[model samples]
Target: MLKFVKNHMESIEGVATYPMISLLIFFVFFALLFWWVFTASKAYIKEVSELPLENDNNQPKEDLL
Candidate 1:
């Protein structure tokens, strides 16, 4: 099996830089994914944190007729 694979690879034409190119492509893809999730989560956390302050500052008062 190993010999067959080696022979097949040797017969292939111009596949030398595939590993490096694939690595770079995957790196950028994951980096963008990480940045997107990080920013989105940060915004959500900030919004959630500010809710308490808003509620405290605007507590509803009972209306007397």
Candidate 2:
């Protein structure tokens, strides 16, 4: 199975560049995400974090009849 797949891939032109392009895309995505995380405001982060708790308290409880 491996040999067959290898032979098929070897026939395709410019297949080697695919891995490099994928690596570049993956690197760029994580780099941007890291930058955003570091640059995000602490106040905004705290507000977003409290959203779940606030909603939980505001929800009405339904007692079974």
Candidate 3:
């Protein structure tokens, strides 16, 4: 694997390495962002699901009029 990589690196033309690195960084950022969104959505669902039951007996109703 190292040999193949070394050979390929020697043949690369122009500044392709920077684009590959940038793509890698963007991929990592997107992965982390999606993970955070997934966790936050799960927590929000759990909180919302528990809310009505928790407030059932204590919440007071008010007349809109």
Name the candidate that leads on TM-score: 2
Q: Which residue pairs of candidate 3 clash?
A: none
lDDT of 2 by residue, 1-65 (tens): 99999999999999999999999999999999999999999999988876765545554344221
RMSD of each: 9.1, 4.3, 11.0
Clashes of 2: 0
Off by over 4 Å in 2: 56-65
Kindly provide the TM-score of model 3 when superposed on the true structure, using C-alpha atoms: 0.41
lDDT of 3 by residue, 1-65 (tens): 99999789878785578889999999999999998877777778777776765545645334222
The candidate scoring highest on lDDT is 2
lDDT of 1 by residue, 1-65 (tens): 99999899878887667888999999999999998877787778787776755545454333221
Show model 3 residue runs off by greater than 4 Å. Answer: 1-14, 41-65
Error of 2 at 63 (Å): 17
Best of the two (1, 2) by lDDT = 2
Task: Compute each candidate's TM-score over C-alphas.
Answer: 0.51, 0.81, 0.41
